[model samples]
Target: MTTPLPIGSTIGILGGGQLGRMLSVAASRLGFRTVIFEPGADCPASHVAQAHIQASYEDAAALRRFAERVDVITYEFENIPTSALDILEALRPIHPNREALRISQDRLTEKTFLSNLGLTTAPFADIPDAAALDGALQTIGTPSILKTRRFGYDGKGQARLSSPREAAQAFSDMNGAPAILEGFVDFSLEVSIIAARSQDGQVSAYDPGENVHEGGILRTTTVPAKIPARLQTDAVLLAAKILNALEYVGVMGVELFVTPTALIVNEIAPRVHNSGHWTQNGCTVDQFEQHIRAVAGWPLGNGERHSDVTMANLIGDDMDRVPALAQDGACALHLYGKAEVKPGRKMGHVNRVTD
Candidate 1:
């Protein structure tokens, strides 16, 4: 087992979004301070972190200074530039490892990796150009999605093609970026497993959560997913296999498509996930703190769910309902201190304990 960092140590967090904001709060609860490195000024995490470094990710000098202050580094998002990682990683350890980030950063690479691990993923083909789109379509077929290879999230950088004629438009939507064409799956429901692995290779996973998405953005996640007992066991084991394969430390979100015969892997997020937010109310140790604990080299926490919980994201106009949500005693509100309220922006989330 890796030696746990002593109390009062500082953890460096990259990306000052809501996930980083909640991570900072969780670190504080464990007697650890957090220093946030974000390019944007007054980011959501800056409000609660011990210190915030406002500089671009590629700024070498700023990264050096930030690394010098913290004992370990972790990121809330996966799209961090390799140049920035080269600098910070040379100075301090970054948990979940760069390999995990590298694989998850690209759709093609991620699918290949999962398949190599004896896992099932949607039929995928590389689309390097418009010409490749036609050839890819011949194999993967229509009613598929064309997604950029890198830096896509929350339904962005993707176009759906219903037929072969739409292939040209789908490739055009990519704006000449490298892309992947994925065949559609006949899924009964969507579910995700939130798993954590300690430095010593100990792994634990929370119960799978059934998810609902609207306009390509996650809307709600409910624990005690309506899956059969056998499938639930398969979900947990498959998640553990991923953690082991990556030799990963810290938490990972594994999204899956539940089919009649098998569970198909959709994608994997290398950090705390929106789908796992139900853990906040259902489990004694939520995904955020579990991530902090694992990266800090602490023993993994008990992630067993004790109650049924449904978590709903507050997007755009959803903020207006906060008043009514606050009055409900069973609801736990977690609002990100983001200043602007734009359409489709994730402002906050509420977890309602059902049991």
Candidate 2:
């Protein structure tokens, strides 16, 4: 077993988005300091972290300095530059590890990994060129979605085709990037399990949460997913299986599709996830805290839910409703300190808890 980080040790976090902000907050609560290495100035996490290194990921000097300052490393996002990671890994240990990042960074790789594990996922094929797209369209059929293999999230880099006639326009949307064609699944609802694994291979999973997405952006996630007990158990077990396969030492979000018969794997996020936000008010150990604990080599915390929670995201202009949302005594709001809120951008989230 790896030694747990001392209380006052500093943790280096990559990316300075809202996830990093929340992770920093959780680390502080655990008596650890945090430093953020993100290029963007005045990023959300920079506001709360002990220090912020505003430099490009290509700056090996900056990455080395950042790594030297912290005892361990973790990241908020999966699309981190390989060069940046190479430098940091040589200096300090990175949790959730490079293998997890390598798999999650590419859609094709992630799906292949899941399928190889005896997991059910959307029927998919690699699309490296127009010919490959045609080949995939022939086998996968229509009513499918074309997604870039890497760097896609929140519905970006995705194009839908109702028929092969629309293939040209859909493939054009990829802009020459390597893509994957995923046949749409007929499912009842989407649910996600937020699971964590410690350094010693111990695994724990919070109850799955039902999710709703609009315009490809997550809108709300409700705890205690409205699924059968057997399915719920299956979701948790599948999540644990994924974490253990990767020897993942951090939190992971596994999204699944519930069909009439079985659950299909949707995708997995290597870092803390938006759908797991309900854990803030619903569980003793929220996902962010659990992530920090795992990366710090501390024992995984009890994540049993205590309250039923429905978490709603405040997207872009939705920030206008903050006044009304704040009036609700039962709602707990977590706002990201983003100065400019563009359309579809996440500004904050509200967890409405019920006893």
TM-scores of the models, in the order given: 0.99, 0.99
Worst 10 residues of 2 by lDDT: 151-160
Model 1: ten consecutive residues of lowest lDDT:
151-160
lDDT per residue (tens digit) for residues 181-247 in model 2: 9999999999999999999888999999999999889999998789999999999899999998998
Residue-level lDDT tens digits of model 1 in 1-355: 4899899999999999999999999899899999999999999999999999999987999999999999999999999999999999999999989999999999999999999999999999999988888999998998999999998777889999999999888888889899999999999999999999999899999999999999889999998999999999999999999999999999999999999999999999999999988888898899999999999999989899999999999999999999999999999999999999999999999999999
Query: Which lDDT values do the candidates have, in the order given?
Result: 0.95, 0.95
Q: How accurate locally is residue 33 in candidate 1, as Cα lDDT from 0 to 100?
A: 99
Candidate 1 TM-score over all chains jointly:
0.99
* Candidate 1 Cα deviation (angstroms), residue 148: 0.7
Where does candidate 2 clash, by residue pair? Answer: none
Error of 2 at 21 (Å): 0.6
